[model samples]
Target chain A: MSTSITLLIPLLLGIGGFIVATSRARRFSDVGSGKMHSLPKYHGYLVALSIIVPAYLIIFLWLFFEQSVLRGVIVNALPDALTNGATPAQVSLLISQVQQAASGATFGNPDPAIVEVAGRLREAVVFSRWALPLVIVLVGLATAAVLVSRIAKRFRARNYSEAIMRGLLIFCATLSILATLGILLSLLFEGLQFFSRVSPIEFFFGTRWDPQIAIRPDQIGSSGAFGAIPVFMGTLTIAFTALFVAIPVGIFAAIYMAEFASPHVRGVVKPLIELLAGIPTIVYGFFAVLVISPFIREWLGSIGIAVSPTAAIVPGLVMGVMLIPFISSLSDDAITAVPQSLKDGSLGLGANRAETVTKVLLPAALPGIVGGVLLATTRAIGETMIVVMAAGLTANMTVNPLQGVTTVTVQIVALLTGDTEFDNPKTLAAFGLGLTLFLATLLLNLVAIQIVKRFREQYD
Target chain B: MMENVSFATAGAHARAPEMPVKMFGRKVEVFYGQKQALHGVDLEIPERQVTALIGPSGCGKSTFLRCLNRMNDTVAIARVVGDIRLDGEDIYDKSIDVVELRARVGMVFQKPNPFPKSIFENVAYGPRIHGLFKNKAHLQEIVETSLKRAGLFEEVKDRLDEPGTGLSGGQQQRLCIARAIAVSPEVILMDEPCSALDPIATATVEELIDELKQNYTIVIVTHSMQQAARVSQRTAMFHLGRIVEVGPTEKMFSNPDDKRTQDYITGRFG
Candidate 1:
């Protein structure tokens, strides 16, 4: 049987169980002296889940281990002459050749021994596919019969269904947390390999960041430097530039939306501002390279100042534009969240709107606003595409916006892009950079959460 | 219809001894969106005395109170038609600045809404915004006298720099009152000011209101007949957006001209 057909048998059984169990539970409720503990539909759901859950679990487990277990069986059944002294890679290649021969798509003339093994592998695969669905159908029928027989007037079907629902929700939650932990562990392991090759002290505190290892000993700049301070500084400079552009404009926009603008005007304008956030970051990268970078160079040149075409300010300005809606939307929420009573108290004291906003609303909403700004700061730090297109690749340790700079994200992309050897220090260094970036943003998010928590406590 | 006519003339009957009217409302009507909240509300607020507006919920008592300082303007859909005058100057005139009008007439809300600032700063905010002080010391002196007048100076003197929101409910209300007083307004409007307070806090605030009437023209809106009777000299009873009766507080509670006022105050029906 095909995999889809195999899966369909459990679904059909579940539906059949549901119909049978529902009618049985309804009969019990109608004929019994006492009331049924749960509704008939809950009984239907309980039986359906009991059949489907275990059947799906078995099918998934069988499918997950089927290929490896089949390969092990095929390898053991092979003669010693065909498999002796073979590396694991060669054995894997030989297995693929056999699988190809079984599928009737052999690339070249095959060995007679391989053809014999391929016939056995084909028989096993066919037997396994048929056995899985037969086993699932039997399990489903057994569970349905047992559960349907156990149904009574006082059966706690609702509690069982509720427990199943809670387990599903917990599984979803645990799945996401485990995925995050998996990524962190992978990064740590790869980063450890990189750190073993490069000293951590030099990687963190040293200023230079040239990661190029010469192919030949005679090559110029042969010894690669791994200092990350310059790269970190560059990241800080660009992020600060973005914040400098985003903060005031974003806050003013928020205040205008929250306090001054009419409902009609706010309704029209807020979505237009948030639309800026919907544009892809790569498009912002293009805008940085084609529009902002040239504009900055020309504008500064007109004022008799020199600047690189791909200056830090290029991507910084575009990233700031990207972050505007982020900061403003969050800040607008924070400002609007301030109690209207406080605004009334201020205005009742004869304070104008400006005084009321500055003296009352801003202070009350300060923590939430700070949290929003910090979140935007992390976004600016982690941004990659725009910097890749507009920022220079050189890790310049400078605060001047007119100079070229590189960031950690840009360096990670540069390191890991193209065909790479897994064991090389250069490729592994991307994991180190990724881990650092992750830590930095994680610390920032924690602080933002703390601030937002305090802010919520203040009012609620 | 006849009852409307009879109650409309009730404000002209049972008048108390003559006193200076600080605020005059002539046929004041308030509308929020399309719904009319107050209809032709005619009343007089005597200078340096508490004029209590007593009614059940949604009877336009609080609406009329907010109209005193033009606080209703903050609600975008709220509209007021008619004349409200402070010291013979029409407060709703196009020439009037709302900031200046609010400075002359302050208000206290039902909920205690002290700014999330220091205790000292909360009171000093008004003086600083209105430039009511010459120097830091003068500002400090104004804050001190305002807090003292609100009867909160002794309690909060040791924690002038602490957040005003950290105070007790009654203390925060008093702090808001002191904030209003710091600007030295001519009139003060209170909208169910003790509704959020415990009995002890309510009594304290009521005593404070009694003391406050000697210096400022006070208009208070309350649901409790006992509160109006205890704290007010002049009382106006509003029912269905019109004045049912306006006279001395004693006569209104004792022998109200309108049946609605009697029904409201006598616990028959509101």
Candidate 2:
């Protein structure tokens, strides 16, 4: 039978076991005190689950290992001259070539000894495809029959089912957490690999940031520099520009929504503000490139100053608008959470609305606002598309926002975007930059959490 | 001004005539949305004395107390249709700035609501915002005097810079009172300030309230009849959104003229 049809064998066995077990359970309860330990359906579920889980697990395992084991056996059976002292990469490539020849795909002229092995590989592949399903069907049916015999009135099917459910829930939760740690660890390892080739001090503190390396043995002017200071400083300058735009406008807009605007206005305006965030960063990058940069150039040119269309401030400014909703939404929640009684207390003391907001409300909500600001800062620093498209790729060290500059993320993209060797520092630098970005965001989140915790403790 | 329309129309026939009214409300009514919380009611608060509003839960006594300083203004839909005068000036008039009115008539909430700040900053907040003090030493003196009068200085004097939230429940309430007093208002409103405190703290705050009556006109709303009797010179009994009786504390406790007041005070039912 085909593999696709073979999947139905386990499912059919499970359904048959459930039917037989549930009938037996129902009869046992009806003939006795009518007090089965668990319900008849639970007994069915227990039998069904036992039949399905083990059967499917065996099928999956067989399918997973069948090809690798067959390939290894075929490789061993090949003539000594073909396999002797071969490196792993060479042997693996030969095995793939053999497999390709077996599949009737054109692989150039092969020796007669190799032709014999390719024929053997085809025979093995066909045999295993059939053997795997046959074994699976037999194992699935046998397991189902055994489980059917075990289902009884007193079986603790509910407990067993619940335990499995709990295990599954924990597995799913751990799966995501593990994925995050896995990403961070992979970044760290690759970054370490990059650092092995590049000296730490030169990479970190060196002023020059050229990342081009010589491709030919006699190529000149190919001494690559990997100093990250200029890139990081560019990131900081851009992030600060975004913050300078975001904090006041964001917080005041938040205050207006929380304290001043009518519910009707807030309901419409708040979502409209958040819509800025929902727009793709690529779109913001496009806007920065086409609209904002030209406006800045034209405006500055009129004033007898000049700037590249790809000035850092162009992306930085649009990024600030994108971050505004991010800050305002969180700040709104923080401000809204301050107790009304505190406001009353201040107002009752004859502090005007402005005085109450400035002295009492803001201070009480300060920690929360700081947390929001930190989160927004991290987001701005990690932002890629806008900087890549609008901010030039030159890792300039100048603090002047109008000059073209590149951020760490922008450089990381540039480094790894095209076909490149992983061993080269230029390409591996992408992973290093990724690790740094991850650590920066992780630290900001840690601080934000601590600030939020301190704020909660104050109220509690 | 409301003596004629009140349940105590016999003020002229009473033994202790009413002191010159410090603040009076005429035909006061409060509405939360469409529901009337306080029916048309008239009440007078005499100067330099503690007057307590005693009633069962949801009896409009607290509602009436909130109305005195227009504290209800904070509630968006809470409507007050009445004339409330503070020292003979209509406080509800559009010309009167609510901020200045609040500074002149400070309020203490039922729950202690001290700002999340140092104890010293908590007291100095009102003055700093209102420009109540001209210099640092002047501000310090005002804070110390307010704390002293609230009877909390000696315990917290050494730790004035500590967070106000760190104080115990009773101390926090006292700190709230000190914060209110720092504004140096002519009248102070207390809304069940001692309810959250223990018996000993309750006694301490009650004694302080009695001492404070010699300086400021105090209006307090209390659930405890004994608390009302112990701290107030005049007690007003409210029932079903109306004033059931108003008299001197001794008379209100001993020989209440209204049947509802007698029942409420005698613990027949609240």
Candidate 3:
């Protein structure tokens, strides 16, 4: 059976159960001497959930454990002569050969024992495919019959349906949290592996970052240096430059929008400003590469100062343009969150508009604004596409924005782009940089949340 | 007929030998977008006295109070027509800078809204903005005197560096009053300044208002009739966006000339 058909069987069963249960519930309401406790639609939803949940559970569980169980079965069924003293890697290799033969992609000639095992694997796959849909249909029908029989005028179907809805929401929320945790764990594990190969002291504190490891023992260059300070410094330089550009412009824009702009102008202009965020970062990347970088180079050259075409300022400035809406929108929310009574108090005290905003409104809104700036900083730190397209590949420890410097994200991309063995320190170094970036961003987010929480406590 | 009677009382009050008009409104009408909020309100605020505007909710008393300082200019849709004068100068004239006018006519709002700054900073903000001091000591003197005048200095002087928002509700209101006084405005407009306060706090504020009127002309809007009778010398009763009566506070409460005022004072209908 095809995968789509297998999926469709349970869906069709659920829809059929819905229709049947709905009509039955309607009939119960008509015959009973009281009003239905739950709506007929809720009854339909309850029946549908009963059918779909159990059926999909079985299908997913079967699919999840099928491959490993099949591999175990094949390993167990192999003759003692073939498996007796083989290492796990050799056994895994033999299993792949068997799978290749099973899929009719075998090369040259094959041994009789291996060919027999391949035949058995093929038969098992076919049987499992057919068995899955059969079992799903049986479970769906069984659950549908059980739930439909229990539907009554006073069944309280809405409660059951709502419970299922709540479970679904919890499941979605947990799924995202679990995904984040999974990424963190994977980064930690791989980063640990990288550290095992390269000392943590050298990786963290060393000022040089060269991840190119010689493939051969006698290669021209020595082994790669994984000092992350330069990359971290590059990231900081660009992020700070971006903030330098973004903070003043974004804050002024927010102030103007929140305090000075008329409602008619704000309604039109706010969305137009926010539209800057909607432009994809990748588009911003190319815009930086194709437009800003060369312009900076030419403009600087004319001023009798030399600058790289991929100077840190190019992507830094462009990313700031990209972040303008982000900072402005968040800042606008913070500014607008300030109570009008404060503004009135200041104005009533004979302060002018600018005086009120600077002396009263800004101080009151400082925590919220700081939180927003921190969030934007994290965004600038983690921004990849613009850095990748417009930043240099070399990690240089320079404070000058006119020079080219590579960030952790750019280096991570450079390290992992082509074919490479995962076990090598070169590839594992990407994980190390990733963990570093993640920790930095996580720290920033925690601080931002703390500041924002304090701001809320002030108002509430 | 009711308008004529209210005008006659206002005229009589304005002609009183001891009291001089500080702020006057002549047929002041306020419109918010297309909705008319105040209709031809005529009232006079006497110098060094508390004039209370008394009405039920949505009666436009606060509207008329805000019109005294042109605080209505802050509301985008609010439009004020007719003449409102401060010390016999037309306040709505383009030549009269609103900022300077506000410095001469300060306001206190219904809620206690102190700047999220230290107690000292909150009181000093007005002086700092207006450049009212020659030195830091002068600024400090202004702050101390303002706080003392608002009767908050004795309570808050120990924690002058603490955030003003951390003060109790009543203290915060007093802090706001101190802030308003720091600039030394001639007239003060208070819009239900004690509504958000407790009874004890309200009493303290009412007493402070009585004392403040000796130096500053005060116009207050209050929902509580008892609060009006207790704090104000002259009272104006607003109903349905128009003044039904204007007279001495004791007469308005005891023997109002208009039936609406009589009914309102006796709790027949608001």
What TM-score, to 2 decimal places, does chain A of model 1 have? 0.94
- Evaluate chain B of model 2: give its TM-score: 0.93
**Candidate lDDT (C-alpha), each:** 0.89, 0.86, 0.89
Q: Please, what are the lDDT tens digits per residue for candidate 3 over residues A185-254?
A: 9999999999999999999999988888889888898689999999998999999999999999999999
Provide per-model DockQ scores: 0.82, 0.70, 0.74
lDDT of 1 at B3: 31
Question: Candidate 2: which stretches are off by over 4 Å?
Answer: A1-159, B1-17
The CAPRI quality class of candidate 3 comes to medium
Write the residue-wise lDDT of candidate 1 on A1-460 in tens digits. 9998988988888899999999988886354454778888889999999998889999999999999999997898778987899998988888898888889988778988889999999999999988999899888889999999999888899999889888889989999999999999999999999999999999999988998886667887647888999899889989999999899989999999999999999999999999999999999999999888778888989999999876888888899999999889989999999999999999998889999898889988999999999999999999998898888889888888889999999999999889888787788888889989999999999999999889998888
Clashing pairs in 3: none
Error of 1 at A23 (Å): 1.6
- Residue B46, model 2: lDDT of 95
Candidate 1 lDDT over B150-240, as tens digits, reads 9999999999999999999999999989998999999999989999999898888888888898789899999887788778888999888
- Quote the TM-score that chain A achieves in each candidate: 0.94, 0.86, 0.86
lDDT at position B26, candidate 1: 97
Q: Model 3: per-residue lDDT, tens digit, B52-137?
A: 99887899999998887778889999999999998899999999988898999999999999888999999998888989999999
Q: For residue A281, what is the lDDT in candidate 2?
A: 96
Best-to-worst order by DockQ is 1, 3, 2
